[model samples]
Structure formats: C-alpha cells, structure tokens
Target: MNGIRKALRDGLVPPPPSAEPVKHRDAGVWTIPNLFTLLRFLLIIPAVISIFYIDERPWLPLTLVAVFSLTDWVDGFLARLLDQYSAIGAKFDPLADRLGLGLVVIALAWEGLLPWWAIVIIATVDLFLLFFILLMDAHQAMRVNWIGKFRTALTMVGVVAVLAGPAFAQPVLSTIGVLCVEVGAFLHIITGVQYARLAWLGRRRFR
Candidate 1:
C-alpha cells in the first residue's frame, strides 16, 4: 500500500510530505516521457484548429489524436524504463492528456460530430475532479483507479474515431470506432460514479 502511494506521488499525485524531492533535472532537460508529453501538447493546438481549417481532413485530426493517444503509453513506458519520473512530469503528463481530450471533445462538438450533452457530461465530471484536486492538499491527492484508466483509454480511442469521421468508406471500421467510444462513455459513467462516491465519503475531510 505504501509503495503504491509512493508511486502515485512520484507520478502525479503530487509529492507527499513523506517523499523526497527530485533534483538534477536540467541535464538534457528532456526525457522520453517529457518528450511524449510535449509532443502530445503540441498536437492539441493544431488538432483543434484543424476542425475549422479543413472540411475533408478528418483523417488528419484522427492521425493527430492517435499519435497523442500513444503519448500516454510511451510516457509511462519511458518513465518506467529510464527511472526518470518526477513530480512535475507526473502532473504535466496528465494535464497534457486532459487538455488533449478536452480539446478533442470540444472540437467534435463544435463540428457537430458528437452530441453536446456528452461533452457537457464529460466536462462536468472533469470539473468535479479538478475541483477536488484543487481543494485537496498533497496528502489527499486522489489516486487514479483502474476503472478510470480503462475509461481514459476508451475515451481517447473514441475521440480518434470521431475525428476520423463516418465517411471512411469502411463501414465496419467506423462502426467499431463508434462502439469503442460508446463503451468508453459507459466506463466513464461508472468511473465517474465511483469517484463521486469517494469524494462524498471524504467531503468533511476535504472541507
């Protein structure tokens, strides 16, 4: 349990009081994980802008989304392989992810590719978590649940599909992409419920 907590702290939970601070990060100033995160963040601006720039370039947006999704995996892998995880990297990586997905959701809704209600729901849940994180100190940082991780993966895949557009000429491929999103949304709802419950249980403590 303590090791898990330490891992969380080292990776994004924020540095707990008990954990030592990291130093000596200015050598190359870039690790594989940081590079992945920077790439992911860099892709977001163009991806969102592309929604309005090209009418028939859905695939471009989808490609960017796919690449951004891979960043999540690559960063984690590099962090483990290189043992270069840092608290700043931990926070920045997840923030990049949320920013990427949040932009995708907004872009899709703006283009009328996805329902506004779904975007609203997602935004609300995200805000809920954001609020908790802002209110909590380092000690109370909420750990990412497995269900939440799965939900995030599904959500990114769904975003990629939406960006790919429905006119891909391959009906089955498109259908599967849409299905992945729907399943992702389902998992999202479950994870949201669980998170809400956890927050409610600790409302007094947080206050």
Candidate 2:
C-alpha cells in the first residue's frame, strides 16, 4: 500500500481528468458571443450590397467578406473563451453559416463572379447535409469533422481569392481561388455522403 501511494505521489500514473478545459454549452443566450453572432448577420446585408457595387468600389465586398469571416471566428472564440454557449446559439450559428454563405455564393453568381453550377452544387450539398443532421440529431454526432473544416477553409479562401484577384487584376489569384472553390465543392459532396452514412449508422445502432 505504501509503495502504491509512493507511485501516485511521484506522478507515475496519468491523470484521470480530461486535459481539455470545460465549456458550458448550456450557458445563457444573452451572452457576448451570441451578440457577435447577431452582428455577423447584420454584416451580411452590406456584403451582398457590396457585391452589386463591386465595379464602383472594388474593395468593399472584399473587406466586408474579410470582416464577415472574422466575425465567424470571433463568435466561436468568444463562445469558448467566455463559456457562453446557449441552445439558441448552438442552433443559430450553423444556420447563420449556411444562410450567410449561401447568400454570398448566390450573390456572387448573380454578379457573374461565380458559375451557376458552383451554386447548384453548394446549395444541393447544404440541403442534403441539413437533412442528414436532422435525421441524426438524436445520436449527438453534431461535431464537425476535419474534412468539413478543411472544406470551409478552402471555400472561404476561394471566395476571398476570387474577389481580390479580379479587383487587383491578378489572374493567377483568380485561377487559384476558382480552383479552391471547385475542390471545396467536390469535398462538400464527400462530406454529404459521410453525413448520410453517419445518420444511417446511428439509426441502425439505435435499432
């Protein structure tokens, strides 16, 4: 018994506690992070407007898009940092992402900045993923996978690249951005399939 006690005292065993900090997912809805999320939606109006006036002020949409992305990061950062995670926020954030990103992509297509097929692919994937999420909500498999994260990053970069590239007359960037978007869209399909499989597995497991 003394020898076992000595081993524990000497830190010979790994700690049983989780290494990650605890986040309060059930925190209040009236928190700063939620406010930031609201602010993100407000910014979207101007982002879309800027797209319409891109020829008049080529930099506006680019800057707003950058800020829009910043808000997305900030809200999540604040959510974790302040531990203010509410059910409304948990639901609202992704809704905002899908809505905001969809609007931006659509607006880009409206302005001839993106192709209609890109819009179709993205919109289709989002709709399918939303359905899958609803189907599998009971399994608690709501966390994002690495592929989804990478796809989002690639898509955002593509958006910014496409905007900035044309504004600055840098065809190289425009090409790269379009490539990123295409690749991201392909990965989006992959993720949709992944989500469907997860939903099916969850249902089977429950059965």
Candidate 3:
C-alpha cells in the first residue's frame, strides 16, 4: 500500500481526475421545440389545402390550424421546460408563425373573406421588418418582446376566428372574425413600428 501510495505521489500512475473540462451539451436546432416548429410548418400545407380546396370539409382544415397554433405555444413552453432553447429555434419559431399567418391571410384575401387593404398592411409591415432584420443580421440579436408576443397571439386568434366564420357559413361569426383580424392587424402595425425603432437603435449602437 505504501509502494502504491508512493507511485501515485510520484506520478507513476495516472491521476484519477482528468484535466479536461466536462462538455455539457447545449440544445441545438434538432430539439423537441424545433420538432414542434417543423410540425407547425407541415400543418400549413394541409391547412391551406383545406381552406382553398376542401370547401365542403372546413373542420378538417380548422382542426389542422388549431393544432398548428397550439403547437406554437407548446414548443415555446417546452423550450423553457427542457432548457432546449437555441438561436435557430428562436428564429425558426417566429418565422414559421409569420409564414403560417401570411398564408392564411393570403388565402382569406383570395377568398374575399378579408379585404385587400388589410393584406397590404400586414405584408408591408412584415416585409419591412424582414428587410431590417436581414440588413442588421439581427435574428439572434433582436429579442422578442412581450408586445410582439401578444400581437402574434392576437393575430392567431383573429385568423382562426375568420377562418371558422366562413367555414360555418355564419354571418355573425364572419363579422366577429373580421373585427378580430382588423384589431390584430392594427396591433401588428404598432408592434412593427416598435420593432423598427428597436432595429434603428440597435443599428446605431453597433455602428
């Protein structure tokens, strides 16, 4: 035992602990939250198909949309719960949401459920934000604020309501849906302006 102790002390045997630091794996693009985001994207095709082509079966598309929207919340919750937040997921989540909402808006406009002016307003704001983000490469840099989140939630609710209204052939539902969409659109504009201001400040700070 003394000999072994001496050997260890003299470094004849390797030390028990390695000098290297243990690498803790961080969450990446391929996480549960990301999967949910992908699922939401996939649902978009079906949702569009149901809205435009599946005229007789509105429930099918509505169900797909509802599930897709719910996944948005689920993925965000899971990201926090599982500590699986990633830069890619952050960008991808909102991109998926905007894409989904854009498609719905376009479809509604095409079907005459929504006015063209509303589409223009939403599209213009989104495009402006997209360009600003691209110009600044601020995908990871720009954090999502509470107002932005609230706007998105409200937009989703409005879109769902509008879609359901026409599907059920209910005038009251359609009216309410239109009102919700208009309100959501207004909120979207406000958030867009706020984002633009933020982007401007961010740009100035970086320069």
lDDT of candidate 1 over 1-207, digit per residue (tens)? 665455545444434434543543332436777887888889999878876644667567767778888877778666755666654565566567666777778777787776777677777666666565444443332445667777887788777766665436554655566567667766767777776665555556657
After best superposition, candidate 2 residue 4: deviation in angstroms? 36
What is the Å distance of residue 17 in model 2 from its true position? 20
RMSD versus native structure for model 3: 14.2
Residue 176 displacement (Å), model 3: 1.0
Which model scores highest in lDDT? 2
Task: Estimate TM-scores for all models.
Answer: 0.71, 0.77, 0.78
- The local lDDT score (0 to 100) that residue 160 gets in candidate 1 is 71
Lowest-sum lDDT 10-residue window in model 2: 12-21
Model 2 scores a TM of 0.77
Task: Give a tens-digit lDDT track for model 3, residues 1-207.
Answer: 664445333222222322332222457778998999999999887888777763678677668877888898788667656667776776667677777888878787887878878878888888877766655543343445666767777777777777777578766876776777787788889888987776677677768
Descending-lDDT candidate ranking:
2, 3, 1
lDDT score, candidate 3, position 41: 90
Worst 10 residues of 3 by lDDT: 10-19
Candidate 2 lDDT score at position 134: 60
